[model samples]
Target chain A: MASIVRKPKDLIAGVLFLAVGIGALVLLREYDMGRASRMGPGYVPAVISGMLLFFAAILIFRSFRGPQEVLAAIPLQAPLAVIAGVLLFALLLRPAGLVVAIIPMVLLGMFSISRTGLLSAMLTAAILSAGSVLIFVYTLGQPIPVLGYWFKG
Target chain B: MIELLGNLQIGFATAVSLNSLFYCFVGCLLGTLIGVLPGLGPAATIAMLLPITFGLDPASSVIMLAGIFYGAQYGGSTTAILVNIPGEASSVVTAIDGYQMARQGQAGLALSTAAIGSFFAGTVATLIIALMAPVLAAAALTFNAPEYFALMVLGLVVSVVLAHGSLIKALAMICLGMLLGLIGTDVTSGTERLTFGSNELADGLDIVAVAIGLYGVGEVIANLNAPAEQRTAAGKAITGLLPSRADMRRIWAPILRGTGIGSLLGVLPGAGALLSSFVAYAVEKKISRHPHRFGHGAIEGVASPEAANNAGSQTSFIPMLTLGLPSNVIMALMIGALTIQGIQPGPEMITNQPQLFWGLIVSMWVGNLILIILNLPLIGLWVKLLTIPYRYLFPAILVFCCIGAFTLGNSVFDVYVMIAFGVLGYLLKYLDCEPAPFILGFVLAPMIEEYLRRSMLLARGDPTIFISRPLSAVLLTLAALAILAVALPAVRKTRDEALVEE
Candidate 1:
């Protein structure tokens, strides 16, 4: 038996939109929705959410009727590695500081490439960390510290 | 005529100063450097470079940013011609005939043609901006909230109309962007709308963070997911740096036509540079004596689109400068730069910050001339840069993205925000959804809401005020007509055909 949803991408997008719209409405539920002439904080958002929901419903309906179109396979490794590297940088920047943060970030980020050897990646990370410290910290004087609580203490 | 000359004088005086000139050179150098890289588009390049301009004066920063823009346009073409890799979307068509020219050992000629054509187009486009911007600003000064609201609607719809993706998907992206944009505290009521109990969300997402994540990081991931190929320069020795007289004579008319088409199309909202080149190439092919020569080292193919993209990119600054409404993502970044400098972009900027306005316009011409020199004489330098491997490049770009986001308000929260959006952007790409309209919507959302609220207040909540005002009515009518036009099957098919070449 054929499934009702012919276009899985559209269905996913529609559901995403649905969640965002309903979530926005839920969040803004407590805010005042004053009359149109004197709109409160929630008024414009309420209107936007309604429109989003309407569009979401249409997308959901259309997904079922449209010719079957398969979504492309989403690559997980590269994006995840890159994102994890960024998350590490974010987590480390304040506590471990810029120098400590950048090396691991660059090293983890280089893992996205399948061919990169660990030695080269480590070298690249060290060079990048030093160069960034020179440019961003020494030359530009960005507010980030070189060493944070971990090293300072 | 007198006013034009006087404005030009102010522009030249400001642009010629040692301060602005130095930054302009730096900007063009950096823009060219990054734009030569295969995976780095102008948007990502600009986003990553935004942090560097934080300390400079508004005029200097703007001048440098504008230089980066057109300089990137120039560099993208160099990559397109020599390596057959378009560094940016606007250079996609240039690769068609440009790479062929390189293969035929006319690499230098092709590079020179693109540079010369772009310089010519840039000069003309700067002149157009100088003449037209003031008049537009004067007219926009009279626009009330309702008219502004209608204009934004027109811009959003026209952007979707020009988008190459599915109409429904683009519209959905617009809605999504607007919702994300509304996350901060409401300006009127001083109430937090969608902060989700987080202090980081109170200020809303920084434009720089969103831009870097969506374009810089998302693009890196996209490039990494694809099969990597090694790129080599087509010709070892690039001879014929100058076009022959016969070649010059053949290209002059196409350059003029391309500049004309690009200047006209660029003033419209959407991806003007990308559209201008596509349309210019199609027009050139249509009018050519030997249309069959287009993809096989046709100099006209190289000249017209190059001129069109440059002209289109320059003229697209019109709305951003005069109306303070960014027509594209690059303009949005420029607006972000202006905002950081405490300079609000609007019609008032013409009278209030004449130096910044005129200086930027003149700096573009200066920057264009610099690009020609840098691109033609130093062509070998850029071609050498194309050899940098993606493995090394992607990590460096990620580092920049992380630092760029961190520099935004000195907040690691912004870095986290960038990561979240980066993931969302990657997922959205899998659904075949473009991020351009989404970015535009994000930039325009607060303005749209502000205008809507003010218009409603003025009209005592009557939505009919949108149609009652003559100017607003006309703008809304155009928006409606544009939506209808794109929805029609015939027009949709033609749009598909026009964009399919890229």
Candidate 2:
């Protein structure tokens, strides 16, 4: 088999990190008045930023010399699904309450599970949500908001 | 000695109460169960349970939670051995040889040896804690800001070695993690660092959100992407729950050595069960007569690391209880729990609450006995759980993670943070970078920053104080040496070779 060529993503990441470190140093310098013996608030940041820059440089250099084979790629679909799930969970957490929000969250989360049918996913999600509600909300008596009108009033 | 005996009597009186003993058993059982599960860690579990402990008495709640914390260490090794997955970072080294042994049909022997070894270590560690608590507390009182800053520096450097990858890559990741840690409001000046104008970022990234996201949710995502063929059952039979005589003989020396190593390493802040397991395994590999048997089916391979991991987990409470310093995330949660109970954790804790302190120490021994009983008999049950369908298991794990994240502060924002970190974790894995060092950096950054600032303030802006303090100077020198040692070409080559083998 032909040798798998790897990308220089490490170098890119290193450069980005180095820039941020340098920017942090610059921002610290803008706000401080100090000598080595009479340091200001910027001292710690300055030191850390300097260390970060040095390490980032090493990373940039090593990425060039290191072996180049990509082991795997992160799937885009799963991350997107996870993001949507969390947002939906957060948005409807209080309004729709714990029971309502958990179902959709679980559904979106299981979207990434390969070969899982929709019916099984929905059923699994429902069971899990109900179990969590029973355990954490009802049984444990944690202060999670239930969607009862009496409580709201 | 009489006074000590009197104190022990009081402690036993406090701990032997039916309610206290019951909670201790409950905590250990739950801890072991959670520990055996692949993606759940004690920190997240404890954080989830913290609010629930509000109703219980301070002593019982603390004792039970402590049981769970150490019990999880014992439980984590099961998953590491049976499957290739480590339940926690401490168990990662156990997976190195434990899973290999499982593949060789020695899963029963490995699990039994680990259980017995952990019990032995737990017994010794509790004794050490009981005898030396006062001295350790006194020593811890001498630690100043400069010392703590130097210690954190050492921790970050040690993390590079622990990464099992290119040193430069690990350092890069550490820096990035620290940067992520700095994204919230600055502690000293009250100004935000990298919030990007988001209100949620003001209090900083919750460690629970980050950990649960990166380790738990991230693992789920990775599992989903794994090939179907590799995901099939290993079909390893776990018949016997007891090790043979020869197995016992082989593991004896290793277990003792691991206990010693673990007890010492556990006292160092930020180096706990995880590092102890790795160090123990490395030591065992170095000393074994049949060194090559390590990756095949060496019994010592499982016993030593598991014992060391448990010992480290037990003794890690030294810094937290004695010095009021929360070394890891679990200890941090314990601090929260204690604060809730109107108990201040500090140097005078043992003096102020003598019975509570001694009772907790005594209870640790009892907890260990309970763990061995709970784990050994239930090995068959846990092994059976391995046969459960992944589809069903994953959904329940997801629900647990959601509940865990939401309950951190009862905030929805934490859930969002978890999702974001989950993505980052997946990306990190794809890039072949380890998440453990990132976690160390995230956990240690704020503390390091705080200490560095305090050190400077005390020194009246003199940077020379770090060099002037003998302890700080030595620690900084060690940190520098650690970085240089790994950065050396020969060392890097050896590490690369090891990774290739792995």
Q: In lDDT terms, which candidate is top?
A: 1
Q: In model 2, how large is the Cα lDDT of residue A85?
A: 78
Docking class of 2: acceptable
Which clashing pairs does model 2 show? A6-A68
Q: Among the candidates, what TM-score does chain A have in each?
A: 0.94, 0.75
Please give the distance, in angstroms, between residue B4's alpha carbon in candidate 2 and its true position after superposition: 5.2
Interface RMSD of each: 1.0, 2.9
Q: Count the backbone clashes (under 3 Å) in each candidate.
A: 0, 1
- What DockQ results for candidate 2? 0.44
True contacts kept of 1: 0.78
Can you give the DockQ of every candidate in the order shown? 0.79, 0.44
Off by over 4 Å in 1: A1-3
